[model samples]
Target: MQLANYLFFTTGCEQALAFYAACGLGEVTELKRYGRDGQPPTAAMEGKVMHARFEGPGVLFYASDNHDAEPMRGSAHILMLEDRGETARLFGQLAEGGTVTTPLGIQPWGDYYGKLTDRFGVQWMLNCRL
Candidate 1:
């Protein structure tokens, strides 16, 4: 069985997408915009992301602009990296223009972990088993 993670961006898909891409999360593919398909979105939602996916090594991330839907309430996404250097780099990048709830450091479990909520209100758990 396969599982995928999806995010509903009420009004900030583009910004979040750009940020994730810049963080080297993965390649954004299959980006569909509103009005491209039947039942176009409202004017305010026009050109927004109807659906998008990010593909990386063993990763499948999905997101959409939920202009008409209820706003998302939480960030349930976590990213795990194997390399300490890469994890540190990404941790710093993700922390840019965001708040770090938990600073990156060695955990008692013999791993490195940190928590942050990005500017777009997406919480992230960065874990590295060094």
Candidate 2:
């Protein structure tokens, strides 16, 4: 079976996806804004991301907005990559405007690693083998 990461945003899933795209995180292959299929989008759901299928170099994930303001906890998505430059670039991009729990570095275990919480409060861990 193929595995994929799914993220739920309190709001701004669309904006988050845009930010991620700018950071080279991934692209949204398909996106559906929240709305009743039989009716035109209501004002409340007009700009909210209902679901988005995101795919990147070697990763796949789905994202959507909950619109209920609930907070997410107890999970951190890990990105394992082999290209040093892309890893570093993505780490820097994800770290912008967020808390860096661990600065990217060559760890004692000999892997380039880092941790951060993005502006949307999504935690991430990145490891690169170069």
Candidate 3:
């Protein structure tokens, strides 16, 4: 299992993905439009990313667009691990007593990843290589 850390901008997820891809980070493995799945997203979320993943070095970063769902405010961001099995274990453990923002699964970027907030309100990011 491998782990990495990252800070994703809350808004402008798509723009950020493109910028990172252009900066030689790695590649935008997945970029799904919010309203493309037949269940169209709200008009305000048309261009927003339902899910996005970017790879750099041995790291995979995940981000999502902020619709009118909720406001996320904090200064913490980290891409935890890059190992699938280990990440799964950690995600399960952390979510056991906390809240999971994103369940561990194959992300749009072709990697296994998830997000959650620990019982202490600290956010975490888990990612594993595809």
TM-score of each: 0.90, 0.87, 0.46
User: Which of candidates 1 and 3 reaches a greater TM-score?
Assistant: 1
Regions of candidate 2 where Cα sits further than 4 Å from its true position = 36-43
Give stretches of model 3 more than 4 Å off: 1-11, 68-130
lDDT of each: 0.84, 0.84, 0.65
Tens digit of per-residue lDDT, candidate 3, span 10-79: 3566665565455344787877776784447777877667777778775577776765434345643455
On TM-score, who's better, 1 or 2? 1
lDDT, model 3: 0.65
Ranking by TM-score: 1, 2, 3
Rank the models by lDDT, top first: 2, 1, 3
Pairs with steric clashes in candidate 1: none
lDDT of 2: 0.84
Residue by residue across 55-96, what tens digits does model 2's lDDT show?
888768999887575555788889998888888999999988
